[model samples]
Target chain A: MSVVSDRVTALVPSQWWQRSHELLSRVFEDDRRLLALCLTPALALYVLVAILPMVWAFNLSLYEVSTLNPVWEWTGPGRLLDIVASGTFQAAFGRSLVFGFGSVAFQIVVGVSLALLVNREFKGAVLARALALLPYMVPAVAIGMVGQFMLNAQYGIINLVLIRVGILNNPVAFLGLPETAMATVMVVGSWKFAVFVTLLTLARLQSIPENFYEGATMCGANAYQKFRDVTLPRIKNVILIAALLRTLWMFNKFDIIYIMTRGGPGETTTTIPLHAYEVAFNQYRLGEAAGIAALMFVFLALWSIVYFRVARPEEEVRVA
Target chain B: MTDIQVDTLRKEFSSDGGEIVAVDDVSFTVEDGEFVCIVGPSGCGKTTLLRCIAGLEHPTSGEITLGGEAVTDVPPQNRNLAFVFQDITLYPHMKVWENIAYPLKLDGVGADTRYERAQEVADTIQIGELLDKYPGELSGGQQQRVAIGRSIIRSPRAYLLDEPMSDLDAKLKKEMRVELQRIQQQVGGTMVYVTHDQEEAMTLSDRMIVMDDGEIQQFGSPQRVYHEPNNVFVSQFIGSPEINLLPATCRDGATVAVDDTDWRVDTGVDADSVPESVTLGFRPRHTTVERTADPDGIGGEVALVEAVGDENILYIDSEVGELRAVADIEQNPIEEGDSVAIGVERAYLFDAETGETVATSRRHGDRSEDQVEA
Candidate 1:
């Protein structure tokens, strides 16, 4: 232990040794005292907020605890494995995947189309861009409430307009049916996230040198050819980054989904995060909740790895 | 091969400020298989004129007839002309092969023929190994070669190049200029090039149109433009270290008083035509430097000496007011503050007000008999 400690101490730098020697002789040195003063708050915050909670959560995930009797018994990694293998937990995990992928796909399509629409030099384009960003700027809870109001079955504006336009014979319960419920959540999530993607794509489009398109036109390439050959390839990296971020955000989304559907009309909208919340607060199953949280943490870590691998910029890839 | 005849081409851009006349009533003709360079200062509408010929920009009024067919409203692609830009506007996302093959593909050429022709062009521009690389992966010079390759593969009626070599370094520019001339000769197409560099125009063109302020100042062969300029602007713009102009009053017949010195200069104009004030233009090479005691010359102290390795340039503050003279390196050296005499020969005189060349005369002309006392 002493040898290992000495090796670790060597990496702390020579200044630490000098300061330690000085402190041993006197209790303070000017440089060492100043360094301590600067690092104290940051170290305290790290220990209290980051390290303590992580350690506590890790410890809690290894126990069995129930709500009825406020007691816990140590069970090693048994509970973590049990939760991973359970059908309900697996279903919730699949639902989370659906939510993430469904939202990201819709967002990329709508976002790229919207960006292209506003990319041209036309009248009222600025207004269109500002209106498109309204969904992103609204608070998540507000967005959920707005979606609920608009998608309401009886008195909703959407249904009213559809009935008046003769597109529907009866008002549809958009958030009630299981299939339609998941689809509605995905659509709402995408609507909210599309603004960020559009902004990212617009920035990428602006950075592409104008000469590229002009050269394409001069080379006998029409509008579609220019977009396919020049604009798309130039902004592919930015699009990937935007998609990755949207996927991560959609995977962890809770407030919007909770407010809109409350994981109701069955477990159709009960994603992994919603399941974790129900276990921790409603059922008071502390150990199971911690296990769910740990599973979510692992899933996100794997996803991030995949994202980095697939979304790496072209410059990082070797060209043949 | 096809001839390009631009008859009174004019273009006016409507900016928020007002109407900016970019190309104003420009008229010229380029014969089949001939290379013509439109040389001008910046903002003189040289690029606009090239774009007009390429059908990239519409003329406000005028007709561009190619092969006796009016092409005023024709689109660029339909006009069958290719343009090479100064910025080397290669599609950064496309590989060199795709870039060079784009025009052929647009014309519905088969895949095999397109690739084969692209390879042939790639070999011509010496970018065969870089065919698969994207434009962003290549250097500026390589990208420019790819751009040229793209144009040449189309076998367009005429090629419009707007300052294509302006972005290259000095050494590369020189090498590419030689290669470009060779390519033009090999293709034998009517080529219209625009550049601000007179040396490039002189080196590469069969004829050049020198323009300034949206008007053609002179249109002639490079040799004619150099030895006999139509106006003061061409005289100043065509040569390195510009020709020097001195104020002179056309006194009694063919005799002009240059400042306090009297010179017997034949106007070469009709005997009846004499202007009150005329400007005397002489190239630095036309002025000879001599010792201070030499007779039959204007003398002054040397202001500056510029050593250009192969030749030397002496700035003399002589009686004609700061004359620039080019002398051989092997000649006797003249340092700053050294008094020297300059003898002018084969000088041109321009009407001072109009800046138009009035006459040119050799040193020993009929006017020499009216020699005046200094």
Candidate 2:
């Protein structure tokens, strides 16, 4: 036993390391124990960064708190419930639905179309595919700033080109009007992120074997029919997963909207996240903002559950 | 069903490296309701030729006609041809019945009618029970059956199969080969099949097109190709153990000196037309081997013996080259490490420089019984 221990010690440079290594080996012999050990670091990080904040916010929602003064007044669920039922929160929720779902749908359609276009075999196709994903790498702040400059009614190049092309007789203040502010914000906000869908959809598209199309052709399927049978079913799962991720991100997206419209044009573009921000900083109502954030979290969790149940996005795409 | 006529079809693919001539001025004709197979080594343009006929590939300079209707510029779907790929490409998301009914669905057939036709096809191909299962759940042979069922369901003008059975195991391949032949006869559709396996081509096709280097080496019945190979490549390619080839020189009208000059095979050609240097060819089944103390004939040692059912395939290491000879195991029990003498009862002489056939000992029309051994 002494010799065996000595050999084990010699395998490692230090006695403490050897003892720990032996302990790890013994613990890893059980599959459940090994899995728990592997997940400990990530679980700890998630609890600290995500779960703890959510729990703190939920606790804060039940009490009336102010950031200016560190005093908390005991309040029941009445205030939180009242804030949820208020017209401001209802309008913000409706706006978020429009923005989030609209952006996701637009991204999926354009991204899949772009992927299909670039998937063809031609000269410089590889370079074209690489260039197509460049937009996704641009910073959100840069897109917001550039969008503001381009949509400027007086001196923007877009207005100049539109006037020269006779599409628009006059320069329109795109983000300064109530009717166009939300639409403009949505399009600009989703510009850089649409290629996230493209990135994944393109990967799935490339993995599909060329023979599938050839087989479809032999089955008397026209071009649209080929896409419907061969391309769509293969990319359906990918598109669903991409839409789910994009919906979550767009719903919680704060930077681009805050930078472009600032929930502006008479509260036209105020989404749920922006509403929560305004409640905290503008109204100095920390407890109300925490309530809104907590509600958003619960809504997203429920939405994700339903999305998974209905869409059934698979982790691995099967090719036949 | 319509016959296909390919007139001087050629296909060239240009890559970054250079231009590749996949099918170089190939021409052939497939009669109505006939099963013709294009067989060759890999990259020999047999698959390309089949693709050209199916309209999956466009020839660089040629015209293709189906029943005398020119379809050179037609798309694959418009050409009304069914193709079975070598990989057995069945849509994974679709059930077996849906895959068989895909063409009818494309034609706007009602779901009930499509299912009825699919059921008929599935029963015909012996896949009736697998109609509800997806392609991912089926075995390789079952997937192949589903593919074939899909092809025959449409009753297209012709069917082109590109090495369809090449992925199956030996036993499964034989079974599918018979099933395909029966389906072809029942459907009576013009079929153009491509394969690199010579045995598959021989057993399945009514006429076989043997190709090499983007050109047709020979196109005839399997028996004619086996007995009267036009060149060295065809003879060596079509046989199982491969034909035995030895370098020789025709000394005169009657005599042809073999490998070591001491051994001579009698030539059955006229002296004036015979080439000087030639390649003597004989099939392993036709060549005879006996244990001999006298070394007047071509002498060799049996290096290996493969007992294949009733016959033994002997691998002989001779003075000139390694020779393959087949023998009846029960009548002549040959073993490894035995010294033997070989006799060529029938032989073909090919021009050595050009690898073209010059003469054969037996005339083409005279089919008679011959002695098996000397």
Candidate with top TM-score is 2
Segments of candidate 2 deviating more than 4 angstroms: A1-34, A315-319, B267-271, B363-374
How many pairs of residues collide in each model?
A: 0, 0
Error of 2 at A1 (Å): 36
TM-score of candidate 1 to 2 decimals: 0.85
Error of 2 at B121 (Å): 1.3
* Minimal lDDT window, size 10, model 2 chain A: A311-320
> In candidate 1, residue B164 scores what lDDT?
94
- The docking category that best describes candidate 1 is acceptable
Q: How much is A309 displaced in model 1, in angstroms?
A: 2.8
- Model 1, span A1-320: residue lDDT tens: 99999999888998988988877666345677777877999999999997888778878899878777767888898788899999989999999999989999999999999888888877798898788778788888888888899999988998899999999999998999887999998898678788899999998887777766766777777788778877887778878888888888888899988998888769999998899899889988888888888778778879888878776753421121
Which residue pairs overlap in candidate 1's backbone? none
lDDT of 1 by residue, B220-252 (tens): 788778877888999999988789888888867
Candidate No. with top lDDT? 2
